[model samples]
Target: MACVTGKNSKPKSMSKAKEWTVEVENLFRFQQAGYRDELEYIQVKQGALIERWPDTGYVKKLQRRDDTFFYYSRKRECQDFEVHKVKVYAY
Candidate 1:
């Protein structure tokens, strides 16, 4: 006979969270909050975060595993999720 698991099994770990989506605007917010990184910069004209291309310094550092990423302390439920919009001016 094969063993079966019960409903009271231990909760799954967050370790399976390998893929992450890094939003450029959030990085910009982090930078404004004093998190500095050459790869993370606010374009004077665009007012948007520069992730790669046209922004070589910071991108290079990111390639070397030297980038600074930020995260929220608490997890939110689907119903509690909110959408934030940022506007950037371009040349």
Candidate 2:
């Protein structure tokens, strides 16, 4: 048998600045293979890279295009992909 408690747990809150930064990241979005996603940006500040996930405002539009060669290595090059822009979230 188990007993129930009536107390509620409190959730931790972050600073407003952190919340705003997160919102901005959510605004930057991208699409791949018909799937919409976000690409983040990292800024180097005070020896640390400020990282966030992008939202929807980044990509103007995504259009279906024929397959193009991203890169070619003489042997087994299909495992990796190429991205035009990327951010470093961690060191």
Candidate 3:
């Protein structure tokens, strides 16, 4: 829980931002699969990524062809990019 002050300088009850743990169910790496480039197949758990604005859902999977890769995310904006720990989640 987080405390937020309103315009009247009074404390308001508010719930903190929900934090989610992300896990990659399967990751396949193919060597020389692309045009002299490596290719990867990433499959994440369903409903792992949470969308806060505009929409709300989870990223199911990612598709890659040649040098172009299509990714689906729940978040509308990008703040910072980084990688964290990955755990296998049973669907």
Candidate 4:
């Protein structure tokens, strides 16, 4: 599946995440699944449900573009070094 940004508008601003928060962690998973963020994922997938850990609310699974699946752990998956790799997009 092609990555879609809705109307093709670019993010108003973007920055590398400095810390690992629940939002950042979810964004990391979304990016890994070829989406710019959760909003884009919902738009592209047409509101498909995203499975999450009930207690911690962390992302538990994601479906990739090729119709494959990616599973994440309940614990933090974005390591310290990898925090910089997660992008925060504003539109």
Candidate 5:
């Protein structure tokens, strides 16, 4: 969906995720797409729509920096072992 761009859209701090959660999972997807997080994606894209699953509210699709799309399942895609690789951005 379209996001509102504002002064606080940029993340002030970031850290590696220590656990698996819906938010973390989404961040992982953004990371895979070469973005630090959703906020950065929105900023770079000028508020591009982010497709999401209706039922689970998980990321359904993402456009990478190369202009290619990456589709994700409604279920959790970030395994337990990969949680640490996800970066959580603080706005």
Candidate 6:
């Protein structure tokens, strides 16, 4: 819901989660050693947390690791589960 005016507009609590995403926006600022002569295929990395899940326990992060990529965190069921995101940039 974009906008809410009712009393129940918000939830009582939220859950932790890790989300991930991919994209290519900027390349001029992208500097790669392996792709110095080639163009940046696409970069990706950890991102931010939009919202928390109440049922599961997890955390979220959103960020741009490269000039043309982004990522998010996802909620893991296991407490010891390590969330790792990889970015593939083809030269």
Each candidate's clash count? 2, 7, 0, 0, 1, 19
Tens digit of lDDT per residue, candidate 2, span 1-91? 0122323322233121122222222222222322222221111111222232233223333222342212212232112132222121211
lDDT of 5 by residue, 1-91 (tens): 2244574566666788898888888888888888887777777787899999999888889888889999999999899999998877666
Instruction: Identify the runs in model 5 with alpha carbons over 4 angstroms from their true place.
Output: 1-10
lDDT of each: 0.29, 0.24, 0.25, 0.82, 0.82, 0.26
List RMSD in Å for every model shown. 19.2, 18.3, 16.9, 4.5, 3.1, 17.0
Query: Between the candidate structures 1 and 5, which one is better when assessed by TM-score?
Result: 5
Local accuracy of candidate 3 as per-residue lDDT tens digits, 9-57: 3222322222332222111111112211111121222222322224343
All candidates in order of lDDT, best leading: 4, 5, 1, 6, 3, 2
**Steric clash pairs (candidate 5):** 1-50
Per-residue lDDT tens digits for candidate 4, residues 11-74, read 7788899988888988988898898887776777777899999988987988887889999889
lDDT of 1 by residue, 1-91 (tens): 0122542233232121122223333333343444332222332222344344333222311222244553332222112122122222211
lDDT of 6: 0.26
RMSD over all Cα atoms, model 2: 18.3
List where candidate 2 sits over 4 angstroms from the true fold: 1-29, 33-57, 66-91
Please estimate how well model 4 matches the true structure, expressed as its whole-model Cα lDDT: 0.82
Candidate 3 has what TM-score?
A: 0.17
